[model samples]
Target: MLQQRQDVINHLAETPFWSLIKFYMDDEIVATDRKKKSGMDLIKIIQCYDSKQQKFKFGDHEPKAITSEDVVEIFGLNNQGVELPNTDKSTKNMKDSFVKAYFAKQKIGKKNDIVEAYQKLVQDKTPEGAKATASIICVHLLQSLLFATFGTYIAWSFITICGALDQISKYNWAKGVTDYLFKRINKSKKKRKNGEESATINGCIALILYWICLHTNLLETISGRENMIPAIGRWDITKIHKAIRDIRVEEIEISGRIPCVEPNESIGRGIPCSEEPTEEHSNINQEECNDIPYPEQNNESSKKKENKTTGRKRKRTEVRVEEDQSITITEA
Candidate 1:
């Protein structure tokens, strides 16, 4: 029993990413901005076992304080046994595919609805219950939408590892997840050529899909679980484990600058550049400025003054005494 416990401890030490998932998360929060970086959830770590003391030492703070019960709880062991649900590669793939499909639809309302159900079903105080509820809700929602006609049994086959974080070996589970994601990327490429109608996959979608798949347990009910394509059964675990040995917590911290709003003052507030005469009149040399004549202004200013006087100096000559002989001829 002691040897087995020691082995588990050794395995955990090798895999750092598992620390984030399995540890007692005191308070995990993502940095809202650059000033405040996100913090990792502290796992209740059993530092070492003292054979002489016949107890576990949790480090300098406490000696001989940790117990087997604590270890079992941290490891998420059931009273029944050490076996975990669907920790295999194929199960991981099913979870991945379902998550991809769910997000592809991008139904925010539906996502929110499922989250609400999880919160309602699982109490906050019980992390294990919460995790399980989340896994179950995720599976149910995906099954309803993706494999509604197929039946619930089929969905279970796919999501065997759902909510097994506490019970399963973190090192192996992490490797399975990695393999599942890599395979999805390769598969998604062929599917993407058909666009959303076919592939409906992208980098952002793939990343989220992988996260959700590991966290949730969405299984498709079917007879043949072993034969599923991209099944973990098909791939060699040793190769996959070696491929991701170097991945660490630091690498997981996504370093990025949030997009800033463009300067609106220049965009909408300023007058059109075409309308504004950018060349300064003062900047031009005297000769050059003078060469640019204003014909309309010059013509208006140089109008003749005779037009004003012409109106007042109208001709006022007396009426001419011409041709008034009609009356005299009649009298004669």
Candidate 2:
């Protein structure tokens, strides 16, 4: 059961549509850093040009070497997770002196407070930082709105975009979400309920509408669309739209069926179903031998039950008889 739940989640997450969304969303951070790096490269070029100009006209002049401080001042690289070479070493003596004086001035000494204060001191001014922060806030806000308006599964489409789910937390979050969703699905199946499926249908409908918004010319070639990557425009949104269409079609088809409430009714052994009895009743009847488990039964008990119910003949094992008997018998 756990394996099935994981399989479902893996299928959903690894789908081209959701995978593309994850990649595009994660690219936001990567793109921001690229922009900052590009800016720093330009700054370095300008510095080199200025140095050459000065040397050409006014004889000897020392060329300004680009340092971490220069990069931080010009491009706010420090806040973009860029390594500042020798930062601690170069500032060690000054830091020691400042710390001594600061300790004398204040009585506070909490580690977290000090860390927070230092972080504030080096906060980024770069466009990348602004974009990353804004993107996270906007995406999470949208997720909250979607979750409030729609069901959990529908809102889960934007799970990859949630800022609170980082690399370390995503695994547990995905597992929990998968378990919750499957629990609901199974519950819906057992009670002959369609609430979960209905919500999923509605959610898919909403997602289709959302996809339409993304594909419209008004929003195309924009920052979120075009800036996703120079090579792939809009992240091949049309393909994802096709996937969404398929999901909607499947949901509609499934929802069209009438649910069967009979315990003896063939719901199709391995596969759970709602109404729409096929023309092939024999195939449906064959499901009586399926390996589905009862509420309190585990796999071994379920298998034993299936063997008893199906009454399929088991293979016989060859057994050697004693010399006196001189006869070989097969044991079943």
Candidate 3:
């Protein structure tokens, strides 16, 4: 009986479902006859071992054996020991197929929503450069999401960190500066004769201003002052530090000279000053300087006029010219 009990426990453990069911429904095998007179009689023999085994060991117990009627009452089964019919193989396969299809549909629907949102963000032009910037940001975000979903947690972390750094370097506090520059350029274009030139100059200035705002901590000051909407994501103090490190002061200087506006001056303010030296004026000035006997004096005079117009003091120059006159004259 001890050997029989060990064999039953080993069999239950070897069968996956039997092991799971046996843990919850304690029982022991008494007979292994395939050709049983009644299935309920076989069930009653198994139940008798289960009930007696609870209080005493299987080999030691000598409790009254359970009968077929007790098995019928406990299992609520007919004489065949059958209740509801077991599921067919095809039914289980169909259930698995349905679950896969449902999940696939849900995944496709989510992908479509993300694609639509991306398209909408790319098409939006309300904030001028928002579409271009958002497109870049969306691409990074999509890549990050993909890495995270694919279980590449290390790759996802690296991508996120790199994206954050790039954002800090390029777009830290850029939204406000860009908007201000765009408005200034549009206004200037409306008023100026050379609209394209003025707009280009203003755009350059906007780039410089954005760099300055990020690098000099001016963004934080302005954001605090006016409660400005942050660029891209939530405001981060470390971004300001990264921006300062990434900014090229020399590039800012070169861009500064292109627009040539003072701090208080608007984007297009100095554009009109540049317009005074038209191509025709430039050519005439070149011809005049070539015709002048004293090239140095002509350059000095040109410099003087420029200084005068720009409200700068100019040094006075003394020129001495020795002239040689030929008597031959041609009259028209």
Candidate 4:
């Protein structure tokens, strides 16, 4: 059972989709318990936004802007790929093809049907099955967290993409989300101009809140463990809500620049501040494909095991003068 578990871990480690999420999260059980949710301040912030210029015009005096670059930086999603195919007929075709290949019926049963289907596939214990499992987890993470909307139903865009999950990283997922947010932000500004009451400010609203948490000092926030990727999944919604509760949009202020909200430094008043940027703006180190930590042991024994196995490899040369051949043994 222990070895089998390691097999699953290593199998998933090599899979591209698994590597993609692990690049950001590198953890299990990222969810937090919550009694409250956040984003009142985010809604208020958007109220002051001018979509034409893509700037947050607090008044005629001070205006600060956010960009798509900021969104991609915080979320750490794929920055380049083919743009998402968004058409009714395309989604319909994807659903038809997916169900026919995987399910007994003409369509998927309901919400989470894909999850059910994924669970079944992994039961076969094949490499393909293991890869399929990783794809589902990756795709679902994108849907529920980054590109999410308010619905019990899954979007057809994601559903269609599931058919080619091996190449999932080839879709410009970050572009899809950033595009949606720009549209939503523009819609929001237009609505308030027409005296429309506060509507459902859609498309990953919490993301903007978290991004603002870095820029302003109004909200109480936590700087996560040093060097860990800023997986938005790690956010505590209730904490965000409590911090900004009872605060009006009129009182909000900007203390840090956008697209560079540093967490390592004391960048702003509330959250962690920006660094001098030793690294490039890009988050993922594409060359380092094998960063996933092995779960071969539990917390009780992991340290000793890690030191014994995962530490630096040493090269040793042995001379066999008595024989014709000299042998070299390298540490694994």
Give the candidate number with the greatest lDDT: 4
Task: Give a tens-digit lDDT track for model 3, residues 89-175.
Answer: 112121333223222233221223333443443444454224232322332322222111111111222222222332322321223
Ranking by lDDT: 4, 1, 3, 2
Per TM-score, the best of the predicted structures is 4
User: What is candidate 2's lDDT per residue for 9-125, written digit by digit as tens?
Assistant: 343243312332333233321110000001111111121223222211111333322222322222121222212122111221223332332222433322222233323322434
The models' CA-based lDDT, in order, is: 0.25, 0.24, 0.24, 0.44
TM-score of 3: 0.15
Lowest lDDT sum, 10 consecutive residues, model 4, at 319-328
Which residue pairs clash in candidate 3?
A: none
What is the clash count for each candidate, in the order shown?
12, 1, 0, 3
Residue 192 accuracy (lDDT) in model 4: 53
Candidate 1 stretches with Cα past 4 Å from truth are 1-18, 21-117, 124-159, 163-167, 194-198, 202-332
Candidate 4 residues lying further than 4 Å off, grouped into runs, are 1-20, 23-33, 59-62, 87-90, 94-99, 103-110, 185-198, 217-227, 231-237, 254-332
Per-model C-alpha RMSD? 38.2, 29.2, 43.2, 18.2
Residue-by-residue lDDT tens digits, candidate 1, 204-276: 1112212211222211112342332212212221111211121221222112111212334242221221221
List where candidate 2 sits over 4 angstroms from the true fold: 1-19, 22-170, 190-332
TM-scores, in order shown? 0.25, 0.20, 0.15, 0.60
After superposing candidate 3, which stretches have Cα over 4 Å from the reference?
Answer: 1-111, 115-212, 216-220, 223-332
